[model samples]
Each structure stands twice: as C-alpha cells, then as structure tokens.
Target chain A: MLLFFLRVINYKKNNYYYNKIEGTIIFLSNFAPMIEDKNTPKTSLSELGEFGLIEHLTKNFEINQKSTVRGIGDDAAVLDFRDEKCIVTTDLLVEGVHFDLAYMPLKHLGYKAVMVNLSDVYAMNATASQITISIAVSNRFPLEAIEELYEGIYAAAKLYNIDVVGGDTTSSTKGLLISVTAIGHANEHVIVYRDGAKENDLLVVSGDLGAAYLGLQVLNRENEVFKVNPNAQPDLGPYSYLVERQLKPEARKDIKELLAELEVLPTSMIDISDGLSSEVMHLCTQSNVGVNLYEEKIPIDPVVISTCEEFNLNSTTVALNGGEDYELLFTIKQEDFPKIKANPNLTVIGHMLDKKSGMALVTRANERIQLKAQGWNPIKE
Target chain B: MLLFFLRVINYKKNNYYYNKIEGTIIFLSNFAPMIEDKNTPKTSLSELGEFGLIEHLTKNFEINQKSTVRGIGDDAAVLDFRDEKCIVTTDLLVEGVHFDLAYMPLKHLGYKAVMVNLSDVYAMNATASQITISIAVSNRFPLEAIEELYEGIYAAAKLYNIDVVGGDTTSSTKGLLISVTAIGHANEHVIVYRDGAKENDLLVVSGDLGAAYLGLQVLNRENEVFKVNPNAQPDLGPYSYLVERQLKPEARKDIKELLAELEVLPTSMIDISDGLSSEVMHLCTQSNVGVNLYEEKIPIDPVVISTCEEFNLNSTTVALNGGEDYELLFTIKQEDFPKIKANPNLTVIGHMLDKKSGMALVTRANERIQLKAQGWNPIKE
Candidate 1:
C-alpha cells in the first residue's frame, strides 16, 4: 500500500550518479538516494561534525516573519510577540526514524531539535519567543553525552534569546526521542494559519528548494564510497550549498518581516519543510481552493541545476518533490504581488485556483499538468 | 556506584514465599506506604488496556485554579487567562533510564508524565492551568499505539482541567519518549520557591508516602512470575493499593487550594516525586538551613504496614526513600503550622534546623542520624 502511494506520486527517481569517482558502480537500485560516488567516500558523524552539518542544512532558508527575532541561528529562538498574541506549535522527532546518528552528531541533533520547533512557530507567522524541549533517551546515552546534548540546547537558547523555561526528561527503553513545544506571541490579526487562501491569490516562496534533498544525496553517496573503501576521504567539492541544506536548515524570519514592511499580508501560509507540492497541496486543501504553479516561474538555484544535470535527474522534479527546504510558501492577493515583486528575494511561483480547477503545474510551453504531492514519506521507505 | 547509593538508603527488603498449590515462588519488597494493596493489584494497566489505563491513571487528579477552566481529560487542554498569575514547569521521562516499562503501563506512564510537571507547579504554590505534550516514538510502534498514549494524555487533561495548548510529535529510532510542559497560575504573593524556608519553619506533607515505590516492587514481582511462565496468571491477591500507586499516581492539587482557604502560606515547598529525603534535603540545601525529621511522626497507610511485614521491609525506610507519591512537602511558619495541623490530612513530620547542624532524622529512640538522599536515580540501575 505504501509503495502504491509512492508510485502514484511519481516523485521517486530510481537511477542517479554519485559525484565521487566520475565513473564507478558504487551500488544499484534501492529506495535510498545517492549521496556520493566512488572516489569520494562517506564520513562518519564525528568527522563531518555538528556545525558542518548545520551549515550544510540551513544555508538557503528565507526568513518570512518580521517578528521572528531569531531563526535557526540561535539556541532558543527569539520572537517579538505582536499585541501579546501567544504563539503555539508542536514538533516530534523520532530517533532512527528522523535521524541516523551514524551520520549525524548529537550536538547537531540537539540543535536541529530546536530548529524544527522554531520552524513551526514561524509557519504560524509568529515570532518564536520561548520553547520547552522534552527528550527521552535510552540507557545507551551516558550522562556526559546527555550533557553534550544540553550544551547544544543552551547554545541555541543563547542564540535565539529565548528562555529554556521548562521541559520533560525521561528514559526510554528503545531509542532516543525528542519533542519540543514552542510558544510565541503575535497580534491576533497578524498571525497566519493554513485556512485563509482565496482564488486569484498569488503564490510566493521565500527561497529555492531541492538543495537539502540534493545534500542528502551527496552524503549518502559519500557514505557508500566509504563503506567500499574506509581509507578514502570524502571530496565534497563545489556542492557545499546543497550539502548544508540537508544537515542544518534554517527558518525564514526575514521574508516575514519584508512582507510586513510592504504592508502585504499572506492570504495563507505554511513552511515548505516537506516538499513544495506537498505544502502547496496543504494550502489548497486547507483553504478549500486549488492552485496553478508555473514551472518556469519556480526558482531553482544554479547549483541545484548543475548538480541535477550532473546526476541525470530532472531539476524541476527535484524542486517539486524534494524535502527539507524550510522555506515559507504563502499566497497573497493580486494587489499585494506588485509590492512584493520589487523585492529581489521573493519569487512569485503561481496563483491560487478555483476549487473546480484542482491543482496543476503550468509548463513554460503553456501545457498544464496535474500537481501531485510526493512528500517525504519516511514510513513508506 | 549505583548499588552503593541503594545500599546506603537501606530501604531494600527481599521476601521469598512459596505457594504450594500454584507451585510458584514469589519475591516481594515494600517501598511505598500510602496506597491500598488489594485495590491496586487487581487493576494493572495491562488489564485495563491503554485507554482504560489513562482513565484509571488520572481518576484522582484535582484541579485548583480558576484559570485552569479545563485540564487532562480533553483533546487539547484549555485555559482562561482571567487575570491570574501564570507559572509553568516541565519534566521529562526516559525509558529504561527513568522507568521500567516492564511494570509500567502506557496509561500510567501518561498519568505520571502530567502529574510530575503539575507537581512542580504545585510546589510553587501555583495552580496548573495548561499543558503541552511532545512525544517521540520508534517505528516499532503502530499508529494505534500512539493513539493509546494520547488517550492517557487526554484522560489526564480532562481530570486536571488543563488545556492541551500545543506539543510536538516525531519518530525515534530507539524508544518511546514523552515530554510534558505545564503552565500554571497563582497570585504573585502566594507563589513559593524552594529558598523561602526559614529557621524553625515546620515541615508538613499532604497525604501519606512510599506506596508508589512499594507498588513498583509488587508489579516487578508479578512480571517476573509471568515472564518465567507465560501460562501462569499473575498472583496479585490483596495488593491493589500499592500497585495503583505505582501504576497510576495523582498530583496534590487539593493541598494548594486547602492551604489558600485556611489563609496559610507555605514558606518553602516542593513535591515528593523524588522521595521525602531528597525533597527535604532540597528544601534545606536551597534555604541554607538544617532539618530534623521525626521518624515516628511520619504518616504511613495501614496497607503499607502489612505489605512491609509481608515483604520483611522496614516501613519507615520505605516511607523515607520511596518516591513518586506526588504529595506536596512544604514548610510553613511555626504559627501557620498550628492552623495546618488542625486539619487531619496534614502531617507535621519535621522542623527546619540551623544550617550548621545539617539535616537529621530523629528516631523514636531519640537518636539523630544524618540524612542523605537515596531516592530513585534514573542514571543508575
């Protein structure tokens, strides 16, 4: 049943090249994406390290909220409550399920833990002011290791300028688990939820996509190469932007501010942590509308294009279904579009459609195609 | 190292009983004292099932705040910000490390999760009003399992009249993890911290102690029996109260209200989740004062006595070191103690001493022994 859904989405790409040895049969078909090639091997979490991964993951996130005092750059995220409107959101990250410590560092794990929660608060169009982090670890983690996790937490808190007010810490017999509850405040009118889009609204994205997905590919390929030859060092040349997107992605706090400065309010909004298609589908479904996205208008970073071509993958498909972008995907009225178009960072991707039209992608050739979401379905994999 | 601490606490007792007809060997220990054994053993969480477990776990939790217009028994906890002071607290629970799920039910787990945090807020002489829960789980669990966990959560919310404002959910590679953050409110003047105790302050406790720990021991014994012989039914005759204390515990919300009604303010306070000794020590250490606990004055339920006799454990030691009673341990001025003592439910077990004298336990024989914390240490076995 899970496979049927995957096939229906048609987002899965089977064959891909590893950027490593220019030419080498590293491995064959499996659900996992290729991260590296033959010459460049994968590195352990301890080697590539925490900061490196964070830098790799969050480079392209566009800030969307003026109230987001701090985004992924801090310890606890900082948010300026508008009119004392309380910000509320929840996040759940499973071990082995969401992360593989074999390739991820504990400190980064802790850092990412805070980032994910902050992302949700930002999605609500509210500045993340305070967060309560909860973690359950198995006996495998030592006291010192737990302390290391907290160090990252404290660091993030310091960076974000949010209080580490309270959280629950318990033991689990199985694996490590973390859950964070983030709270922020905003004006009752300024806060955006998922249910406000209307027909003819312009769809806008804060930043480019597919870089994080590609980064994961690079890491996986490198991992395969290292398994074949442990002595080989990873040569992650020229793909730093893509690589960073996967390890430490950021939440867009700036674009949110820009929109406010322009006096433009999003009709509806959600962060693209899953995939563009999935997030767009969410906006449409929640708002009881449809959408038409122009393929030509979708922004693709040059690095993503080059990498896609090198790997024999369609850059469009990568942008459409690739996950972990953490960019803001929002819609605004037509009148607001002109005001935002002047901003170099904002991209008008498409427009909301009437419910009867359903959701579709309009190619540069003017050919219309149905837009289906192939989200990051970890369970299916 | 862990064993050294356990031995020092000296609460350990082992008993071997041979049931001729059943041809079974049973090992028992006495740890908690407040609960009725028979009532507790019959309704193990497993027997009641997950949803049943939650209902059973939160049956006794009381709400004391007007702002907490709602609590543990809801889809999302609700709160009314009716000009009341707000206070918040959170705690985390880990598997294997913090609890042996072997004897702990999912419902009880949920109940305990909320109680622990609520207890913290109660310690501050605050009324708990809202809570946010976060959970991380491994794929080893089915969606139904997660629902079961939430069932327990909802049960607690409803029971306590706390609104479930927000939380996070994610997957874990290893074990099940739950983190609960509770928000409470109280008049500014009424809020109590651990450092408020003064010399000659009377130490008082709400309700009896030690049953939860003893309840854990009974469950462990039954589990051992079932593990050895899958076909054998658990022989939990006449130990219900103790088992319930271990499985489904309640927070002391009532005491907060009662204190307010009597017009008595506690000088210092903390909840007894980490055993009376540890809490007492905390009050002394934080307040820079000494304490002398009269052992004979400590309250013990009748069931605790019979269980202690049956298990060959000293009831006093069990009451001292057993944890998770969810009762409030607090200090009041000498004048206020008379007001509190007039209430039958309150027990004045000890009084604050000078800092130079340190913490001590006054035995019935009039001998004073230095007190040390030998409570449940999750880090140690």
Candidate 2:
C-alpha cells in the first residue's frame, strides 16, 4: 500500500501513459464544464451542504507561485512581500448567493470565506499578510455556533500568521454574511498580472485536475442515498483525495516561491478557481493569444480515474471542466522549459498559439479538435 | 441673505457662530433646556433615503486634530502620517440590510460607503490616505447603474485626492453590497485612543447634532408619500436642513488639521457615529470614567430645533440621542479649554468626572438628569 501510494503520487512526476482519455490534456480555458444532458437531473444548491459543495467545487486547484506564501489554508494568507509593494483583496459572502449554509458547516464556511479573498491576493503574485473580517448574522445563529465559526477563522489565521485586526459586528435581517479583506506586500518588480503571457510560452499547471468535481459527484450521490434512507452511511471510500480537495482547498503559495527560486518568471498567471478551461480562456483572451493542448499530457489522479469510471463519466471531461483547483495556470518562456521540466510538481500541458490559430485540443488518437469553453455561468442558466 | 451667506462662508475660516437661521451658529450643548417627557416619538431610519440620511448623520461632526489632514469628504480620508502614526478601518454595506435599494441612488450610496469607513479612521484621531473598495452585485442591476455607482466612487476619490488603487468585482445573488477599507496615518505621539480621557478633561464638539436623524425622519416621511402617490412631490421644503444632512454628509478632516495648527491634542477622541450620548458613554466606559455634560452647551442647529418643534419633539432630546453625526467627540485638558473657547467652531459641552460619579446631564434649570443612549439600534426595530 505504501509503494502504491508512492507510485500514485509520483505517477505524474514520471513520464508514463496511464490511460486513453480523449480530450486534449493541455492548456485549456479556465471555465468549468457543464454536462447539460436532461437525463442528469439538475441539483438545487440546497441539496448539497456548503462544505460538500465547496469541497466539490475546489477539487482540482494547484498552487504554483512561491509568493503565495500561504494559500487556502489560513484565515488570511501570508505573503513574503520581499520589499515595498503591498496588496490586499477582500469579498463578501452572502447566504443564498455565495453559498447555502444548509449544507455548509459554519466552520468550513468561515474557512472558505477567507480563502476566497486570499485567492485574489495570490493571483497578483503577492503574499497575503493581515485581514479584517466583518460578519452580519441573524439571531438564528447561537453564540456557540458563532464560536465554532471563529474557531475555524482563528485556526486559519494561526496557520497563515495573519493578524485579525478589527471588524464590525452587526445584525442582519436575513441569513449570515461574511466579508473579509486581506492585505499583503511584495516587490513591485515581481508582481504578475493577467495580461503578460505571450505567443509560444509554455502553459503549465501544478498537480492533477477534476478530482474535486468528481468528489462532489460522490458526495451528491451519497447525500441522495441518505435522503432515501437516513440509516445509510455515506460510502466515501476511495474518494478521500477528492473529498479533502473539496473540504480544505489550499492556495498555491508554495508554487509561487518555487517559480521565483527557479528564477522562472511566468509570463502570465491566474489561480484556477474556475476550471482549467475557463481559466485558460481568461489567460488567452486577456493576452490576446490562442493555445493548443495535448490530451496525453493532462494529469489525472488514479482515484479520480476510478471514480469517473464508477460514475460513468469521462475522466477527460472532468479534468478539463472541473473547477476550484486553486492550482496555478501560468506560462513560462520556452527557453526556461528545460529548468521547469525538472520540477516534479510542474506539468507542461500545452503551448500558446497565435490568436488566429484559435484554442484547440489534441486527443489521445492524435487528432486535433477545437476546444470551446462552457464554464458555470450563473446568469445564463 | 447675502450677508447671511457671507457670514456662513466666513464662519468656515474664523470659526464664528452667527445666530442667523441659514448661516453659522455653534449650538452649545450646555445651554440646551431640559424637557419633561422623555418619550418623544423617536425618529425612524426607514423614512430617509440613503443620501439624505448620510447628510443628516454627518452635519455636526467636528475635526479637532491637526493630523487629520482630511476627514469625511473624500474617496478615502487623508491624513499626514509622515510624522505620526496611522490606523485603518473598513466596513461592508449590504443591500436589504445595511440599506434598501428601493430608495437609495447609486451615487449617494457610493459616497456614503466611503464616508462610513473614513469615520472609523477619524475616530482613532488619524488622517486617511488610501482606500480599496470591493463590490458584489446581482445581475438585476444594469451596466449603466454600475457606471453611475463608479461615478460616485470616482467623485469621492477625486475630492479626497486618494487613488482608487485596487478593488474586486463579482456577482451576488441579492442586491448591491459595497465593502470599503481605508488607510490613514497620524503622528505617533499625538495619537489618541478612546480610553485616554482623564477626569475633569473638557468635552468639545465641532458642530450641532440630531439633524441627520431628523433628516432621516423627513426622507422616510417623503418616501411613504411617494409610495402611496408617486406623483406627490417630496414636501421637503421645511426640512431641507435635515434632508441635506442625510443626503451629502461630509467628514471633518479639515478640523483635525486646524486643531494641530492651534496646538490642541485631545486626551481622547471618538466619532459620534452612534450619537453624542453613545460616543460619550463609549469614551467614559473605555476610560473607566464618568462625564458631566451641561445641557446648554450641546449645539443644536436652529433648523434642527425648528424641525423638532414642528414634529413636537424637544430639541434637547434630538441633540442628545440623534445618531450618525460623524462629528468628533473629544476631551482635552483644562489648559486647552481657554484656547478652544475663543475658537468659533469648537464648543465646550461637558467635562469628565471620576468613574464613581457615572455619566450625568446638567439641565438648563440646574437639575441633574442621567443621560441614556437611545441611538440607532437596527436589530431592535
């Protein structure tokens, strides 16, 4: 079992053909895929608890920047900031909008609230430092429950070394709302923007994708089973990787530091809160470039593969469209590829193309297929 | 009217108080007459539009410190942090809770949002410098409305001379929500905390109070009229003072600088956001002291008094309990009292007492009445 675990972990690190997934495994866009077949019953947000949903959502993110200092693991992320420039970002999470509290534990909700803001600061290639959290909660929440929420906040703060400076506590008319602002500092020269990737730059990602989405699928299935028979225990066996990815997603602060250490400045970068396909499109559209990804290069975990097969879903589709992978999708110059190739955590999936070439995918059969983005659009459907 | 206008303009410079109805007058709290009935129909917030409400709320705010280079008037408040210390504060405003969009204009909402955050920074006796804003809105809002909101934001930013450095935009499931974080700096030596007031220190305020609350009442009344008969023009003529108080409130950043130039360092300071009475209570409780506020010295604007009379409410009660004045409530040593006494804008309202004495009010009829806080409590109603 130890050897098997090691092999599974090192599988992507070694160059080996694991399966015959059809879609291109390369530089896809950042949006998550939507399996819009009427046969698959649509689920309402209330069906999955907040924790289960967040776990389902963030399964495939990989942190790629070292300045990310601390990622999804803290109350507020910590960044080295090297010297000079400091940046902070925050967002408000309102119930019925950001998440449904019915399925989300107050603790995980607090944790995820902080993570969402910290993700933005990380996207700037800066390290997060301090945060102020404001919460408006209805009287429905007991003092003990509020304490549980703070426990999660305090735990993440300790893990990230962020100071909980000050915030307002007010009564809300409806459900719970959380707003967190995170601050960080970095050397002005080192900060990366979304508009820096160039044609021919190698597109790379850290770690495997699509597990979080599959994890959500498994949880959803289990939730349905329990609904039918309350006595039925959830069979989450073999879905540990996906479940963990969903529950406590970590930001890619380490990857930021590794890139700096390797002296590889990514031309452009963004965190994969959305799926790989959506994020890739963001990079492409922002940089005014196209990309060509090879399906053979996409990383897929063994558990994800087995789970996808069990669920009768395409592993390639899951990897391509799965969201919340917090992994870094960045482009490095072709000349730096030799140095980056040695990093076990780094995966070179595709290359940037001219805008006219458009975004395409190379299947396992070596046939080129055009790639289109179908991310989660709350407004459209 | 010309003479009155000139006097008002000059009051800005000489700090003189003219008793003219439309000009400038410092409503001394110590001179207010005591009322027999305490149960005056308290004003309701729902009556006022957001802008009118903010204007009414900040009318009497006084700037007392020199380092407070800029107070409530900008995108982010400005302060001279070069020589002193600085502190930053922020808060989030959510629709359906913090405000109702049914009556709020995007422009005023944007301006008021920045002002609210700057108030906290001023409460710390620091001047604001920079601000970052993050907003989440549902699709129900149009692009033009968003632009209007930005116009208000940029207008405040430009007026305050603070750059709109960064912010985040995302979709919300509910109405609009704005979160503003402001940064300010002050001299470390001159920095004042809420807990620094000493026994017998002189209490001072910059301007009058209760107008904002009254303005809220007026707007709410008008709103009700509009709701029933959309064609009914808002009968706001008599309550213009209150309306302005609520619609376009300004921070007293200028007063902070004047205090520095005049060489007065307040022993303790806090913004009268909750109301003069509540703020005094906060300072006294935090400092482990009591206060003796002379009713006659509390500044009550003639418009506020007339409006209060029209509404059958005592001017004294309105001045004492009305909230959102954003005026600085501060205490100074006996020695500084003489310097401020001659100044037109500053009014000595009361003095600190030992903790054993507790907080009390000295009525105009020489009666001792205990002061109680009846400021805005959103949760109660």
Best by TM-score: 1
Q: lDDT of model 1 at residue B193?
A: 77
lDDT of 1 by residue, A80-191 (tens): 4333555556666776677765444456567777777777667767667566666665555544455556666665665565565545455566666677766665555777
Candidate that scores best on DockQ? 1
TM-score, prediction 1? 0.77
**Model 2, span A233-351: residue lDDT tens:** 54344675675566455566667678888998888887776678877887888789999988889888899998898999988888888776667788889999988998777899999
Tens-place lDDT per residue, model 1, B147-220, is 54666677777877776665545445556667777776666677777888999999998878888888777767
**Model 2, total clashes:** 94
Off by over 4 Å in 2: A1-83, A198-200, A224-233, A260-265, A285-290, A334-339, A353-373, A377-381, B1-86, B185-191, B225-232, B368-370, B379-381
Error of 2 at B292 (Å): 2.4
For candidate 2, the per-residue lDDT at B11 reads 23
